[model samples]
Target: MALLYQFFTALWELTGAMAPYILFGLFFAGILHEWLPENFIRKHLGGDTIFSVLKSTLFGIPLPVCSCGVIPLAASLKKEGASRGSVLSFLISTPITGIDSILATFGMFGWIFTIYRVVTSIVIAFIAGIVSNIVGERGDKDPAGSSASPIRPASFRADPPAPGQAGGACGCDGGCGAEAERGFSFFEAMRYGFVTLMGDIAKPLFWGLLIGAAITVAIPENIGEWLSGYTWLGYLLVIAIAVPMYVCATASLPIAASLVLSGVSLGAAFVFLSAGPATNTVTIGVVRKMLGSRSLIVYLATIVGGSLLFGLGLDLFFDTMQIDPRSVVHMEEHGGWATLLASVILWGLMLRFLLPPLFRRKRRCEGEEDSCCTKG
Candidate 1:
């Protein structure tokens, strides 16, 4: 019973700490969605030069999208004539570091850790982009050998997409033009920021919090001390667990924090953070389908190898500098009433979007025996 209480307390604290920043991040994302030109990304990212890759990485870093959401966006970029390297860089950087994730990292960890994560993510993405360019075929052949034409337009479209048409996959439902068509009103931004973006992240964030609380309760307090003796083993163990998992960058922060609280090395936690959100089985298959097998290989190799090397460097730096992960965790800023308010708003949005629709479907199934929900 006491353990259960502690677990809930920890979960609430973590949620409150992250809620405000997440709301802020989502608002910025909505603003970007509304204001950025329809052809902004496609126009700048289609070239075969290193500059294109750098632009892609930079563009992806602050965008709020996860691995699952990035697939369709990357597909759109590919369809619009983005180089394979630029696409790969966008894929690598976007999911691993975002405005939401960066803010959450700062809320849970500190400025130094947050900066490390962002810089390392960019470096890893750059390496992957460069490697993909070197190994990838430069022609207009799709992965399945279909010929694709470059779709660069001479001018940007001022009007947004009509209703029901899907937008660019930056985790926005209506895309860039959707809001523009509606005059980019405050209410529209609020809906996208609080509702659409919340729906996108709610499930993953829920699971992340649950798992983080579970790890807090399950792992012994001295586990870190025991694992400290086997540093490389810890790194490998974390990588093995993180590589195929689908945890989002923002959601993974609390879990990493809990792991650090349980005595895991910062580097080991860093490994999990680096690989967990960016690379998953579905993402790997999607990359293979989008780029060739060679680009896929380079993508996987860069993330895996770069994460390990960066993880080792972090550990060495911590040891030499006498920095403590626990101290960083303790340094996290505690939220006051605003955080609590944000948490309530976030939960309300999640329930409205994630649960009520299912209940409605179930109710409809109860009324109609031939309903698709009943059939399924």
Candidate 2:
């Protein structure tokens, strides 16, 4: 009971710190969705060259998609005129960090850490694309050969998940749907952010919060001090856990914070941040299906290797500067009325999206499927 209470307390505190930024970030994601041409990225990334890969990476960085959410969109790019490398680049660059995740990161960590995360994502994504183009096959010739893209695949084996599926839960956000009118509407943006995108992530966000709080309760504070010199162990452990698990960007912040409190070095915690959001078991299957076994290997190697390399650099930077990343943490944004209100609102929204399905499932299980369970 005491452990359960502690877990809830940590979960509430972390929610207060993260909710405002997540709300703002979701709105910003909607704005990006509405403001940009629906086909803008598709139009640019259809090339087989490094430039196509770069564009895919740049465009993917700010978008608020998770590892799962990115699947259909990447598949679409592959089907349309995107090169395999471009598709691979898009897959990697996205989900490592998103706008919502970035703000939540800044709210929890600091500007320097946030900046490093973004820069590292860019570098890693670009390297993966270039490597893919060099060694991975050109699945389809693009416009350079009077076709569409070298970075784009001519054909992908598996179809993206259907609309009601996990990856397609938010109407596939930017991935599976046809182009929306590029004209911006404030109402549409709010609906997309608060309703569509938020709905898509709400369930995971709640589970992530529970997991984070559990981590806090499980790991003792300042245990990191003892492991300070064994950063490699932290890296390996995080990779082992992160590569198979799925955590969204915003959802990952509190989990990372739990590690930080447990004396996990900032650099090692960063390995979790970078690796957890980008690679997961489900996504591994998707990559293999979309790009081939060879590209799948390249994809995994790049994310795992790049995460380790960048994580090491981050630790070195702090050590050389005689700084402790833990010192710069800013989780004190909690305990205010404003934060409490935000947490309340966030909980309300989370429940709104999460409860209906469970209720409907119950109805179905009770053999009421022909009744209102049908609507659900």
Candidate 3:
């Protein structure tokens, strides 16, 4: 019972810390979605030059898409003439750090950790992009000299459309040109921010917080001291766990914070933060199919190796500076009324998206009387 109370308290505090910043991040994302044209991404990433690779890295850094969400966008970029290097860079950079994630990192960790995360993500992505250019297969073309279609397998192609594309009658796709054609409105931007983007993240965020609380309750504080002598092992373990998981950038924060509080080294926490949202089993398969096995190798090597190097550097810096992780965690707990209000609003939005309406369910049952009645 005490453990249950601790778990809920930790969950609420973490949610409050993240909620306000998340709202701001979502609004900014909506604005970016409304302003940036898809063609703009395609235009800049078409070349194999270093400039294109850098552009891809920088452009991807602030976007809010998760690892699974990014696959379709990356595929579209590939089909629309983005170079292999640029595509790899975008894939690496986009999921690991975003505006929302950055803000949440600051709220949970500190400015210093947030800066390290953003810098390391860009460096890793850039290195991966350059290596991919050097070794990856040339453009998307088959040996028969025919243009290859989307790299995703036909079976996997049915995943939801990229966030800003038309999916249904709402015309909620944030394509600027489409908005202009239909007459843009602020209400539409609000809808995208509060509805579409919120809907996309709600389920993942819930699971992330739940797992974070569980970790908080399950892990003993002494576990940190037990692993202190095995820093490298800790890093490796975190990478192994994170690499195949599908946690999103924003959702990863609470989990990382919980691990740190449980006495995991900050470096190991960094590894989880970088690797968790950046790669997953589905993402790995997509990269292999899209960029060929060679590029896939470069992608995986860069993320793993770069994450370790960054993690080690961070640990060394903390040691030299005599910084305490607990002190940083204490600093993050300054949330007040704004945080409380934001948490409430966020929960409401998440519940709205995650739960099916009774009216809609009843209507569906009525429409399928034979099946519904038989089940009843």
lDDT of 3: 0.76
Predictions: Cα RMSD each: 6.3, 7.3, 6.7
Query: Model 2, 148: alpha-carbon shift in Å?
Result: 16
lDDT of 3 by residue, 1-376 (tens): 8978988888888788788888998888767665565457778888889999999999999876666667867886787778889999999999998777888888778788888899999999999999999878666342221134332211111222245554321123342112122334566556666666676678899988889889988999799889988887899899989988888999988888888888998888889888888899998887887888878899999999998899899888988999876566632553677888998988877787677573114223232222112110
Per-residue lDDT tens digits for candidate 1, residues 9-128, read 888877887777787888887676556666678789998799999999999898766777687678768877888999999999999988778888887787898999999999999989
Task: At residue 326, give the lDDT of candidate 1.
Answer: 77
| Candidate 3 TM-score versus the reference | 0.85
Model 1 spans with C-alpha error above 4 angstroms:
138-141, 145-183, 330-335, 358-376
lDDT of each: 0.76, 0.76, 0.76
Off by over 4 Å in 3: 138-184, 330-335, 358-376
**Each prediction's TM-score versus the true structure:** 0.85, 0.83, 0.85
The local lDDT score (0 to 100) that residue 125 gets in candidate 1 is 95
Distance from true location, Cα of 73 in model 1, Å: 0.6
